[model samples]
Target: MKNIYSLFGLLFISQLTFSQATLEGSIVDENNQSVLATVYLPQIEKGAVSDVNGKYLVTQIPNGNYTVIISALGYETLSFKLSFLKNETIAKHIVLKERAVEMEEVIISTPFHKLQSENVMKVERITTEQLTKNGAVNLSQGISNMAGVSTVSTGNGIGKPVIRGLSSNRVLTYTQGVRLENQQFGDEHGLGISGNGIESVEVIKGPASLLYGSDAIGGVLYLNPEGFATDNETEVDGTGSYFSNTKGFNSSIGAKTSGEKVKFLVRGSRASFSDYETGDEYRVTNTRYNEYDIKTGIRFQDKRLKSTLRYNYNRSNIGIPEEIGAQNTSKELLLPFQEIDNHILSLDNTLFLNNSSLDIKTGYLFNDRREFEESADEAALRLKLNTFTYDVKYNLPELGHFTTIVGVQGMLQDNKNFGEEILIPNAKKVDFGVFATTHLHLKDWDFQGGLRLDTRKIKTEDARNPQDEDFIPSIDKDYNSFNVALGAKYNFSETFTGRLNLASGFRAPNLAELTSNGVHEGTNRYEIGNPDLNNEQSFQTDLAFEYRSEHFEAFANGFYNTINNYIFISPTGDVIEDNRVFNYVQNGAKLFGGEIGFHLHPHPLDWLHWESSYETVIGELKEGGNLPLIPANTLNNTIRLELNDGGFLKSPYSFITLENIFAQNNASEFETTTKGYNLLSLGFGATVKWNKIEFNWGVNATNITNESFINHLSRLKADEILNPGRSINFNLGFTL
Candidate 1:
C-alpha cells in the first residue's frame, strides 16, 4: 500500500510523449434531419451529446478499435465499431430509427459483451441514473429495488445483501473485474465499497460458480467502475444531500483527467447521520454513524494492450443501536460502536492477440475491524484480515460461430485476532480453480455451457490463551468440488424470447462456521463451530420468458433450487456467558420462487409510464421446517412522467412508488413471524444549465404514511424494532 501511489505517479508521467486521434459525427433521423442524441463510448467513458443540429465531437481518443453508441429518447439506439490510427481525424454520419421501446442493451459481465437479447443466461442490469432516481442512499439500498434482492440491515449504517433468501458467504460481489474480500462473514459487516465511481451494476440471480468459481451459490453482484475520461479532457463534479429524519448529510467531489494514452481520477466523500426516528417519533439511540472514503484509479492504453490500476480506502464509525433514547439530533456517537478500515488495490490488464485475448487480474485487500463497548477508548474485539487473489483467462480464437474461454483463479487469505475476545481462531485459507466455457451463436438460438473444478484448504491455529474454555482447538481441513452449467436462449418470434438454465454450485465452510467457539457481539449469541462440517452444494434450474414491442414489455421468471448439507445456526437449548448458545448444523433445503413484471406506455400519452412487479421466495429445510432469513413476498407499482426536452428543466421527471409487503408466517425455529405493511414514496428531479454550469437536483419523500412495520429480512426484526419513519431528502449536484 505504501508504494502504490508512487507507481501511479510514474505511469502518469510516461504517457506525456504520445498523441491521440479525434472523431466527429452527426446523428440524424431517418429522413436525414437533425436530431439531438447522446453519443458515448461505453468502454472509454468518453463522448458528447449532439446539439440541436445533430453535431458531436470527441477528441483525445486513443488510436485503436472502438465501439460508439448513439441513443435518443424516441429512436432505436445505434452501435458502431471502427478502428483508427494516431494523429487521425475521422468523420462519420449516422441515422437512427424511431422506436418507442429501447433496443437490447449490452452486458459486460459475460466473457463476450453481448446484448441481453443474445445472451444464453439472463442478467438484470441497473444504471446509476436509475439508482439515483429511486432515492437510494447506499449500495445495498439501491440494489434492493430490483426483484429478488433484499437486505439484512442494522440501522442505517450497516447492511448485507440477500439474494433470493441467501446472503453472507453464499453471494459474491465483484468490482474492478475482481472479487471483493472485506471480512463479510460477520452479520454486522456492511459492503465496504461505496456507491461512488460506479457506473452500473449487474445481477445474476442463480448459481454462477462455473464463471466465478466459489461463493456464488446464491448469485453475483457485479459493479462496473467509471471509465476513463475522454482524451485531452478534464471533468469535475460535486454532490450534496441532506436527510431530514436523521439530520444526515452526504457530500462528495471528484475530478478526472485524460491524456493521449493515460487517464487518472480521484474521488473523496464524507457522510454523517444522527439517530433515526421511528414511526412513533421515537429516536433509535446509538444508530448514528460517520464514514470517510477515498478512491483513485489510473489507466494506460496502447494499440494492443490496456491496463488499469485502482485503489480505495474506507473508514467508518458505526454506533450499534439497542433502544430508543432522547430525540435530540446529534452526530456524536456513543459507546458500544465499531471502527473499521478497509483497503483494496487491484490491477487489471488485457493483451489483445490477432483473434483472441489474454486477460489477467490481481488484487490485494486489507481489513481491520474493532468493536468498542462501555468505553470508546478501549476495544473489546479486534480482527485483521488480508487477502491476495489472481485470475488469468485466455480467449481461444473463434471457430465458425463458437467462442471459447479458459481461465484459472486462486486466492490466499489470512485472518488474525488482535483483541481480548476471539470469536474465530487465527486461520489461513487457500483456494484454486480452473474452468472452461463455450458460447455458440446461431441465427435464432444462443447456447452456453461451462465446467469447473475447485479445491480449498484451511488450517487454524489454537487460541492465544490455552487455558480458556472458550478457545477452540487447532484444526485442518480440505474440500473439493466439481461444478457444471448449461443454458440456452431461443428467439421464438420477433418480439418473444425464451430462456432456460441449469447450474450447480458449492461453498466450503468459512472460518466462522468451522472454528467459532465464543460469544459473537454482532449477533448477540454464543456460537459453536462444527469442525466436521462438509461442503454445501446446490443445484438450480431457471426458466424465463419475455415479450417486447413498441408500446409495452413484459417478463416472467421462475426458479427452483435444492441444496445438500446446507449450513445454518440452530439453538442448542443452553445459555453461555449470558447469551443463548447456537450451534452450526447442516440439513437439506429447497427453495422455489418467481418474478413477473410489465411496463406499458399508452400510444398518445407516451410521456406517461406505468410499471408493476411482484416477487416471491419460499425456502424450507428438507426435515419439515422453514429456512431462516427468507424474505417476505413483495409487490411494487410505479407511475412516472418524463419530459424529454423541457426548455429550462431539461429531462425533468416525477414518480410515485407504492410498495406492498405480505406477512411472513413461514419462519424457522426460534424465529417470529412479521406483519405486513404498505409504503408510499414520491420523488421529482430535473437538470438545468445556468452560468455555464449544469445543475441537477431532486427531492424525495419515503414512507409518507409513517407506518410502523418490521421487514422480515431486517436483522433488527428479531428485536421487534420498527423500520425508519417518514424521511424527506434533498439532493443537488453540479458539473462543469
Candidate 2:
C-alpha cells in the first residue's frame, strides 16, 4: 500500500512530461462484433484482458519502434508494429480468423452441469458447439437436461426453467449481458426470450445480485450472442441449418459480410411444435406452440472507434391448458401470445494516454411485451409492459492491480392490466443502480469482488367509476438494497485449481411484488399487493476443486446459501385494517446443495471420451420447513467415439448418454413423493462435404425406453402423471 501511494505521489510530482506515443485499439469477432476478453500481448505480457468493450489501451513506450501482437481464444493471432511520434495516440483494429482443430485457445469448454467451476458458486455454462450439435426444438429443453435443473412444464409449450427448484422472477434471464424483461411472476411467461439467436447459455446458480441487478436471487441465465467467425475471408459467407423432432420442426439461417471499414451480420430462425405424449401414451394437451425471431447488427470499425447497432424481434404463440386435477382435460386452451421486440444500440470509445487510457461505453435498450388470451375466461389476466434502459460506464486502468468497472443503469417501465380487474392500477416504475467490480490477481491466487446499491421507485394511478369510496387513486413505493461479494481462487498447479468463496447478497422486492393489485388466473391467485415488504438478504459460501488435462477437464463444488426475510405469499386471508388483499411477504429461509462432475480417458487411443456428472439441492425455512419445488438428486453419464485419421469409429463422431434424474420423494410440506427412474439416450453425428461446402448431420434419441417417471419437481408428478416418454430429433447444418 505504501509503495502504491509513493508511486502515485512520484507520478504526480515528477511530472516530467515524457513525450511518449500510445497504441490504442480493439479486437472484435467477425460475426457479432463483440469484444474479445482474453488477449495475448506477446511483448509486454502473455495474457491480458480487453475491456468489456473489446478495447485495449497499451502505453509507456518511447519513440523507438516496437511490435504489437494480439491473440484471442478460438481465433488466429496477428502481429503488427508502427513507428510512433511523441505525444501521439494511434488507433488500430484487428480481425481474427477462426480455427477448429488448432484453436488459439478454447473460448468456452466448460459444461453446464459442472458443480465446482472456477470460484463462482452454482455457475453453469453451455457452449456454442453443444447448442449447434445438439438437436432440441428449443433451448429450454436442452437446459433442463443438465443436472439439478428442471422445468415447470405447463405442457410442452410453456415450460419455465427452474434451477434447484426456483423460477420466474426468482431467477433472472439475460441476453448477452442485457436483462430480460417479461412477466417474471407468472408461470406461463417462458417464451419472452428467443433462444434461436443465442450461441451460449451461462447459468449462475444462487443469488447473483452482486453481478446482475435485482431479481437474481434464484440465479441468472445469460444467453450470450454469437461472437465467432461465421464467415470466412471471402466477401460474403453464411451458414444454414434445419432440424426436426417428434414434437417440433425448426430451421435457422445466418449470413455475414466483412469489409475494410464496416461489417454486417443477420440471423433468423423459426420453430413450431405440437403436444407431446407421455410414456403411458397419454398426450399432454395444449402443448402446441410456434415462435420466430430475427436479429441483425452492423459494426463500424475504425482506427479510433468501433460501434455496433443491434436489433432483435421475437414473437411466439403459447397454448396452455388450465390444470384440472388428475384429469388435465381442459379443452379451453389459454393462448397467451407474446411479441417481445427488443433493440439495443451501443458505442464504445477509447482515448489513448501515456501509461494509461480512458474508455467510455454507452448503450440503450428498449423492450416491449403485450399479452392476450384466446379465451374470454382468461381475458381478465392480461397485461402489457414496456421498458427502456440506458446504461453507461467509464474505465480507467492507471491504478495498478485495481481496475474498477462502475456503471449507472436506469429503467423506465410502464405496466397495465386488463379484465374485470379488482385493483388494477396503471403504474410506472423507475429503477436506478450503481455497481462496481474489481479484480485482483495474485501470483498464486486471484481475488474478485463487487458491490452495488439499487433503488426502485414506482408510481401508480387508479381510476374507475366502480371504485369503492375508500379506494385510493394513487400509490407510491420505493425499495432499495445493497449487494456485495468477495471470492478468491488458488492455483495449485499447472492443471489443478481450487477456490473458496464467501459473499453477502440481497435483492429488493420488485415492482410487481410491491404494487400488483389485480387477480391472476394463471396461478389461480386472488392476488394482492404489499407496500411494506423489505429486501431479501442472503449469505453464501462455496468451495471448489477443478482439474484440466490435455483431453480431460472436470470440476466439483459444494455451496450453501441462507436467506433472511425470504419472500412468499402466506396462506392467510387479507389483513382487515387496510382492506388489502393477501400478498407475498418476506420470512427467514435457508438453502444448501452440492455438485460433482468428472471426465476420464483411460483408452490407448485419443478417440474415446467418457464423462459423468451429479447434482443435488435442498431448501428450508427459518421455522423449519422445506422450500418448494427444489430439484432432487440427478445423474448424467456420457461417452463418445471419434474416428479421425485413425480412431474409434467409422464415422467422424458418435456419442451416448445414460442420463438419470431421480426423485427420492419430497419431504417438504405440500409435497408429493415420486418414484425414481433412469433414462438412456443415444446420439451420433458426422462431417460431410458437398463440393466445396462442408456440413454436419446430427441425430439423438431421448428416453430410449419411453420411460414413464417424473422428476422430483415436476408439477404433474403431484398427481400421478410423471413425464414425457421417448423422443427423437435430427439436425443438418452447413458452414463455410
Candidate 3:
C-alpha cells in the first residue's frame, strides 16, 4: 500500500510540472475574409504568424494577464487584453480595418505596455524602418524629422538632440532600459549610440523626471532594441548604402535564430565617409568620419520567468572642421579630432506570480573619449566614464479598472582622467530614487498620476596645477528634490480626443558646471564653474487635441514651461590664453511652444497622401533677454503615393517634401541672427520578392536645388560655414 501511494504522488507532481497555457487565434479583414497577420505578446516577447487559413497558435504561455497585438500590411492593427488559466487553451478571433497610415505599436518606455491610442500621456514613436525609409543619415538626424524636435549639428558625423528649445544636459536619453551617460554636459559631445539593431525610438516632449531621474528637466528620448525571432525560426539579412556628396558607404549583416525556450541574435555594421561638399562644390576640410559597431542579444522564457541579455559595442573616429581648405576625398582623421568608444551590457527579467508580477533590470556601461590636437599619436584630452544602474518595479494586482506600479531606481558612476589636460576633476557620483504611479480607467476618461523623490551626491578630488590656469578645489555636495506628474485623457466623441498634463522636473548641477577652471577646446572659451550652484527645477503644462477619421487625422500640441535656477554661461568681458572668459549664472526663465499637423488621404484616392506640419518655440529670461541657442520656427509639407499592388515590384512608393525655416531675429548678447531658407527633397523605393528571398531598394535626393544655407543651431555657424548640400543616396538590402 505504501508503494502505491508513493507512485500516485509522483504522478500528480509530474502532471503539475508539465501543465501550461496555450493561445490560438484567427485573423480576418472587414469583409470577413481570411487574412495573413502577425500575432505578438509583448509581455513574454513571443510571437506567431497566421497561416493561409488565418489560424495562429502560441504555446507554453504562463498563466497570467497579457496584451496581444495583431497587425497586417495596409490594415489597422488590433490590441486587447486577455487572461489565461493553467493547462487551458483559449481561442480568439479578430477583424481588422483597412487604412493607409501605419499601425500603432506597443510602447515600452512606459511602465505599463499599452498601445499609443490607449495611453494617458502623449508620446511620439517612430520605427527604425520608417527612419530608413525617410532617408536619415544618422540616428540624431532621424529624430529631428519629428515635429518640435531638432538637432545641434557639428558636422556630418556628430549631432545632439534638442527638444523644443532645450539641449545639452537638460534632455536625457535612455537605451536598453537604462540611462545613457557619457559626459553630456558639453555642447560638442555627441550621442554615443548607433542606429543599427535598434527597433524604435519614443519621445516624451515634456518634463519626465517622475519616470527618469535628474537631467530630464526638458524631456526624454527612449530607444528600444530589436526583438528576437519567433519560436522555431531562423533568418539572415544584409544591407548596403552609398552617398554621393560625401563619397560614403555603410554596410551591415545580421542573423537570428530561436527555439522553443531560447533565442539568440547578432549584428555587425561599419560606415566610412569622406569630406562633404557644399553647394558651391567646395569640400569642407576634415569633415570626414568612420564608425564600427556590434550588437548581440540572448533570451530565455519558461512557464513563470522571461529573461533577456543584450550587449553593444561602438567605436567612432570623427574630424573637426575649422574652414573650407585642403579639399580631398579622404576618410582619414586630421588634427583636432575625436575618438570615442562605448560598451553597454544589460539584463532584464520578469517574474509572474498568481496575480502580480515583478520586473528587474540592470545595466553596465563604459565610455572612453580622447581628443588629439597637436599630435596624431598623443591625445591632448582623455576622459573615462563607468556607470552601473538598476531598476525594480512591482505591478500590483489590478482592481476593477485601476492599475498601479511601485519602483526603485539608482546608479553608481565614476569618472577619471588619464591625459595631460584635466577638463573636469575625478569624481564619484551616486543616485537613489523611489516612486509610485497608478492608472484609472473609466467609460470615456483615463487618469494617470505619480510622485517621486530623488537624491544625488557628488564627490570630487582636487586638481591643482600652479604652472597653468587649471585649478579645481575638492568639493563634496548632495542635492535632493521631489517631483510630481498628473495627466488625463478624455474622449469627447467618436472622432475627437483631448489630453492635458502637468508635471514637475529637476536636474542637479553636473561636474562641468560645478567645478571647471580651464579652456574648453571644442567651444574655444574659458569656463569658470560655481561650486555653490543649486538644483534646477521646472514645471510645465501641456495641452493636446487629436482628431481621427477613416481618411483624415489631425493633432495640435502646446506647452508652457517655467524654470527656476536656470543655469547659463555668459561672457565676463575678460580674456585668458587668447580665449574669452565665461562664468556660469542662474536666473528664472520661460519657454512656450506648439506644434500643429494634419494628414489627409481622400476617400477615392487612397493611394495618395498629403501631410503638413508647423512648429515654433520662444524662450526668454525673466530679467528680459532671449535665451541662447533657441531653434527657429519651421514648416514642412509632404506628398506621397503608394502603389501596393504592382506586378513584379511590390509595395512601390514615392514622396516629395518641402521644408521652410523662418528667420531667427531674437538673439542673445553674443549671438547673431540667421536668415530664412527653403529646401526640397525627393525619394522613391520598392520591394521585390523572388522565390524564397526578398530584395529592397531605394533612392533619395536631399537639397535637390543645391541651396546653400546655414542653420542657426549649427556649431560651425560662427565661421559662416554652409551645411552639406545636394546629396543623392542609394540603398539596397536582401533577406533570406
The number of the candidate with the highest lDDT is 3
Kindly give the stretch of ten consecutive residues in candidate 1 with the minimal lDDT sum: 8-17
Q: Which has the better lDDT: candidate 1, or candidate 3?
A: 3
Global lDDT scores for all candidate models: 0.85, 0.62, 0.88
List the candidates' TM-scores in order: 0.92, 0.79, 0.96
Q: How would you encode candidate 3's per-residue C-alpha lDDT over 376-437 as one tens digit per residue? A: 89998899999998887777777888888888888999999999889899999999898999
| Residue 636 error, candidate 1, Å | 0.3
lDDT of 1 by residue, 84-180 (tens): 5667889989888887764456688876676676678889998876786677777788898899898888898888788999999999999878888
- Clash count per candidate: 0, 3, 0
Error of 1 at 386 (Å): 1.0
Tens digit of per-residue lDDT, candidate 2, span 1-736: 2453354345433322346556777878777475674543322222345777788766544443334556654355454445556768988776765522122222221111112323334356676557555544567767886655677665555667787666777787766445667666666557455566677777776677766667777777777676523112332233344332234677777877755446677888776666666787776655566777787776664333345566677766666544432334332334554334455444444333333333334445554444445543344344566766655443333255554556566667787765444334677888888777775645677677888888888788764543654343567878788888777888899678887777776676665566555454444455555767887888778787888665567888788888888877655555444443456777798777878888775545556778899988878888877777777788889887766633322247778888776766655655676677898878788877666666767877778898887766555555565466787777677766
Error of 1 at 104 (Å): 5.2
